[model samples]
Target: MFKAIADPTRRQILGILRGGRRTVGEIADNFEMSRPAVSKHLRLLRSAGLVVTRKDGTASLCDLNAKPLRTIQDWLQDYEAFWSDTLHSLKKHMEEGQ
Candidate 1:
């Protein structure tokens, strides 16, 4: 999943799909790339379980599954804590210098 979302293109796709479901064509419309290229990105996202698609009459609407986002968030938690500690130390050092 991390590998899939590592690309900037894929990240933008997620952003486009953030509000609600959208057809592959709708997603392709936002990018300069070919529809097949967008489809490939969607395929990777789908394989990662980050996206889910369902038929809406003649179109397929893809929606964010969100659990994969949680996975990414959990992975980022360590970095969040590390930054928090570093910021705290920096604040203390600055206060001491003052």
Candidate 2:
């Protein structure tokens, strides 16, 4: 899943799908890359379970899964306090230097 989202294009695709379901063409329209490139990103996302695609007649509709994101968020929560403390320490050091 992390590998799938490692690309900026894939991340943007997720953000776009967050608004609602979109057809493959709609997704490709937002990016400067070719439709095939966008399709490749979508394929990776689908493999990672970050997004699901369905056939709507001749068009493929994509929607954000979000469940994998919740898992990723839960894992990141473990480091939240460490980040907070580091930020606080940095702020204090800067203030003293000033």
Judged by lDDT, which candidate is best? 2
Residue 67 of model 1, lDDT score: 80
TM accuracy, model 1: 0.83
The residue-by-residue lDDT of candidate 1 on 8-72, one tens digit each, is 99999899889788999999999999999999999999999988988889988999887878877
Score every model by TM-score. 0.83, 0.85
Q: Each model's C-alpha lDDT?
A: 0.92, 0.95
Candidate 2 residue pairs in backbone clash: none
Against the true structure, candidate 1 has what lDDT?
Answer: 0.92
Q: Which residue segments of model 1 deviate by more than 4 Å?
A: 90-98
